[model samples]
Target: MQKRPNKISRSRRKNSAQTIFTRFMLIVAFFILWIGGIGVRLVHLQINQHEWLAEQAQDQRRNQVKSKQLRGTIYDRTERALAMSVQAKSLFADPAEIEDVEGTAKKVAAVLKLKPSDVFNQLTKAKVENKRFVYLARKLDEDAAEKINDALKNTDLRKFDEPRFAGLHWKEEQKRSYPQKTLAAQVVGFSNAEDVGSAGIEQSQEGLLHGAVIKKWQDRDRLGRVYDETELEEDERELPKDVVLTISNSIQYKTEQALEAGVKASNAKSGMAIVLDPKTGEILAMANYPTFDPNRFNEVAPESLTNRAVQSMYSPGSVFKLITYAAALQENMIKPDGEIDCRKGFIEVGGHRFNDPHATKVMSYGDAFAVSSNYAAIKTALGLGKDRFYNYALEFGFGSPTGIELPAEARGQIRPPGTWFGDSLASMSIGYELNVTALQAASAYA
Candidate 1:
């Protein structure tokens, strides 16, 4: 019976052959479909979106021409440049290209006058995917930048000591330089790392000073010699226009001297003075004690960096007598020689006794001013009436900025006439209650 089974299964053998062939054909069809899908995707990426993808790839490596505007120069009345830009180089590195971050940072530190940690941090900040370069240090001297460029040569261990390892590729960027450290720092102002002005005349005339820089498509060879091929429009490289100031450097120096002496003598926290050409509105000299140098402005105290003569308002103390006396005389309430019998230097107004710091008896208006008698001045102001007196103070330019070309000018305050009663009127008359700026006092005197 077993011998008969060997010859009886021919149909079964045929069915088995068909099943194997069907599976083989199905596997071949699946492979063909997979290959066809891959080909279609390759065509879509290489041809359908080819231009846009090529542009994106080119943006990552191709040399791009960027126009850099040169910032304007500032000059004193003497036509000497108070502020100007000088060429400086910013150092950059490609972290992916750096073989040893720690060692490279040390070499950069040696050349750039920077900390090793700082350079390392800056180098590491470059995005691994998007960044081909990153700035290591900005505004470095050419000599230092050269030293760094040289240091990048040699192997990781030998580069610092070797002379030639510094030739690694890095991009150079332009930096703005200020020669004078802090002279006229508040007035001349400063530029950001990008060379944009933040304050003062630098801010006021920023448009005029920043000149046009022309950029055109350039061709480069293996030698990296960039040459312009096409007449890509006239990129006129207009230098920044110069700004002339009304300030006199010599007079400014003298005023600084005077202000320092006065500040020391008064033992005050801070002080300022401004001298103006009474005829013209030009500020002859504006001085603030404890001024900061413009060159290293970030190192100075923010308070000291302010031009107090323009930005501060003080009580004006005895200096305000000039305004009070002028108002009284103009209103015909008191003559220059008018006598006030301020016996014992005490006057009762609304139950408040107004007295001078040092007492005086009867005095003329001129003598009252010369002595700064608070009682006599109050008497004059009371006689003049608050309405007329307040108007006169306003007319004299108190409670207003002088409209000078400066930053942060403050307008001093005078209480409204409606708030003026006996005490306030008397207090204001003696220069005790009123707030006035140095500029306002000078203007009233002028």
Candidate 2:
């Protein structure tokens, strides 16, 4: 009751109250701004970039699995598989994840019949280079890979609790198998470890055989458990079409056998033969000497792997006389029964002298053909002259490839009349000077 407060004391008291209120407001404002900043960040991440964040998480959770990307089955006209793709296993390892590198190399080498030193060197190199994928073995048989997996499991090399093994891993791959072995080796050809067509039909029909790789989306957990699988778009998914050839199995086998015998009996360096349907002109069988097995193509020499029927060019010999006879007969230059002076199996043309196997003073045109008379053929070609001779050969598909469905086909060489030497016509009449393939001659005869 007695002490009335001084102005200075009241002022100090009000100032202190004001200071406390200001500090309290500042703290509340600071907290509000901080919380609002956090909320804005959450909105941006959740709404604006939701798909991007989801993809990032998915990338971490799922593993991209690449398949063997095998080619389609190659079947004969009868649906017998000549070249086929089969399921097999390939072994690989992550250098970073591999523990006991030397041990892994030795153990795997023993099972795969690979040199331990080679395996060890490769693994060590991969580790030093920080490589994630290294193939230990490729295109192994299913039973063979299982043996390796068994070995790894028994030694506790594969850690079951881990996301992936810290050791060897197995991948399913497609391997090319030739069921008929060397039966149609050159015809079917072969593919490499990567399933690439190397020769023959395999190389020619690579587009249809080697289908596109399908990248499928699979949601897998850390333990490799499948959560969900997304269907690939129809456009993205490619199923290789099976290739059916016009080759017949029975005819092919017989042709090969006969050709083999003929080659051996003749004691020739090499030979090639083709069997075709005269009406259809479809290749029933194509055989090559010293043929190789498509299954073991690597072990054979390159020459054996050649498809000689359409690739090798040689003189037609007496076979080409058919063209000369046809041209002469069609032009009515000589009748089948007309007599011609063979000059005792020798004839002179353009300062060149030619001899025949059958020496006859005078013989009918048909008799001259039956005896394969070189003199008769030369005279016949000269009678047709350079222009008619060249035209007849051209009409028979000479000087060009037959355009048969095969790889590395060869087009025979033939000079036009403008380029022909004086003796060129004579030589060509007997299937010389010009080049031709076994298939070409066969087709002409057909």
Candidate 3:
């Protein structure tokens, strides 16, 4: 039995040695394949996705922001500031860094006077989505922003060692402000919350007034605190050009007061008045009734923001009679002291009768003009004929824009002599068929 056992033991030992060797070889092959797969994955990550991964990582700790340069200041002829850009703070938050979303929302709502529930919901959504930037309020007033900053300082988690609102920050921004408020509001126009001009001169001169856009990159800590800021290299920055208007602040104020009073007393819907320097053709004052404050332009009707002095077109009425009388006198068609019969207050033309509010049997040309007698004007214009009258009107700068540096200036409606109807001369003489703007009227009188 001992001799037989010896032989079996030797065979079993040999079989065991072969089984261990096979297992070692299989393990070595499996490991080699595993290492090759890992190497391939590393190559793909380093080569293919390097830029995207780097950007992803950088975006977490850095932000690129656009900052608007200060808009040019608008001044009156005397160099008094009308519209200007003021430095202000715009509040924002990094939602991912906001540890207490509800608490932060409440604090922001209280400071900004916003709806708490709305702010809370927005903050919650942003946090859940891991948003990095969210604007809470823009262009806050100095007093309000100072109060918010004070509150933040007092409740700072790092400074006060208390659980406080985090991820709250502010950026510098330019806010368009009209220190004169309603003064020259229509002429100066207004810029909206986004610093875009909406009306009047502000819109017409936007290209010159708007400053260059500045771009910057800012580095932030894990808590979203901006620690460093660097301006990115760009093309030359153009400083905004200041606009110097010929408007007189004193005259504009007085004119507005007078116009407002006149409109209210006359029970009129709206009114406009323009005063010009006769020698220089410079506009001294332009005033509109029911004018709005440019600061609160968004709260008013768009129609109310219209600069009626240049934008509105209307019949010149008796005002146009000066042109007819001048044309008649200039052509020697009628003497300065000549008398014309009113036909007892009415006259007929093309089956239409034109009446005179203040009429007499016979009156001097000067008397006719003084009383604004429609019959006398029409009679004088008829003597000048159609061609002469139209030419005179064109010479007076009617039927065309005055070329003032303002937006939406109406050229007015002037039909050609060929388009005139049978009674067109009579109608035009009394200023019924012709249209003109207030600025045109002022220029003509000048």
Candidate 4:
């Protein structure tokens, strides 16, 4: 019995040791497989996926911008520059390179005098969408751009070797500049940042003054520093044509100075003047009161933009008598020295009395004209009849546009004899029953 118990104890001890050894071997095998799997994954990523990840990182930091060629210049008759394009700086950003977007946006806005919330929203949207580029400001002034550069360098957040923030950057662009701020403002007009002409000659000659648009790309580094740059190279043929105006710069200056003084002295609401060559009818100078600078056209009153010399219409008053006298003289209705009676200083026509402020009675046509006698003019027009008068009126270019190559030219008003009242001819003769622009009256006599 004692020998059997000793054999059983030996067998149990042997079985327990075998179970313990098997358990240790299984644990070791599991650890080896886990480590080997990790190594395989590391190798695949390094060899196969490296290119794709690197491309992604590069794309995140890459910056590209569309650039345009400079526009053609505008010169006066003497080849003096009235409007030209100058190089200006524009601010931009890349959200992918920017960290702490909210904080960066606040600083940018404060320095740029922009709305903080606007900057934050734009930056946040770009970051969420993984966009590479965004514009912060366009066509910044020299002082303004310098202020941004100074702020970046002097800020507390700047490091010794790097900028205070990422994504803030600047690029060159063309800005329209006018040397003569208010001179010929209405005639010269102005353009917008899109290189589009909005008013005056700028609007009319858009095809000639606006240049071509070309794409230009510039590469930037992670800290928002440009490493590679490209520029727009254009020959004269590819650029827009420079415009030469008929206006004389010296004449324009003198005309504006005189007009401004006259308007101020007269205390008039507004006024305009145009000097034209009688021989060729070429306009030398056109001026208007209450003018605005093209550089700051946005701040002017809307009424001031009107080119009143061609647009506004008013009755020529006593000026129409010249037309009547010439028409009567042409048809042989009266001679320049014919006799007319204006002793009463007033005459009755269709129960309405018309008075001559300064009248001479029983005078020659010459004397009547010299005195501006209303009676003599009325009688002559009646003798000619409305039919002949209407023909002469149309011949004088009344009731028609002058075709001045200017915007909004007004066509003066004239009624046919068929539409006239019994006294219409009389009123027309005295310059009362018709509308005429200043240009029309001057043209009639010219």
* Highest TM-score model number: 2
Compared with the true structure, all predictions reach lDDT values of: 0.73, 0.84, 0.87, 0.81
TM-scores vs. true structure, each candidate: 0.77, 0.86, 0.81, 0.75
lDDT per residue (tens digit) for residues 195-256 in model 2: 88989889998888886765567787765566887755556566677899989999999988
Each model's total of backbone clashes: 13, 0, 0, 0
lDDT of 3 by residue, 136-247 (tens): 8788878877777776664426622112346777777989989999998899999887888878788899999998899999888876577899998877878798999999
lDDT (10s digit) by residue, model 4, range 1-446: 35445888889999999999999988888889888888888888789998988888767776456766787888888999888887788888889868888888888898878999999999999888988778888887788778777776636554332234566767678899889888888888889878788888888788888877765556676645667877645454456788888788999999999998999899998988887888887778888887899988878998999888777888877789888889989998788878877787887776678888766558888878777778888888888888998899999999998877666778989988888887888888889889988778777877
Candidate 3: TM-score?
Answer: 0.81
Comparing 1 with 4 on lDDT, the higher-scoring candidate is 4
**Residue pair clashes in candidate 4:** none
Question: Where does candidate 3 have its weakest 10-residue lDDT segment?
Answer: 155-164
lDDT for predicted candidate 2 compared with the true structure: 0.84
User: How does model 4 score by TM-score?
Assistant: 0.75
Candidate 2, superposed: residue stretches over 4 Å from native: 1-53, 68-70, 154-165, 234-238
Cα lDDT for residue 85, candidate 4: 85
lDDT of 3: 0.87
Model 1 TM-score relative to the real fold: 0.77
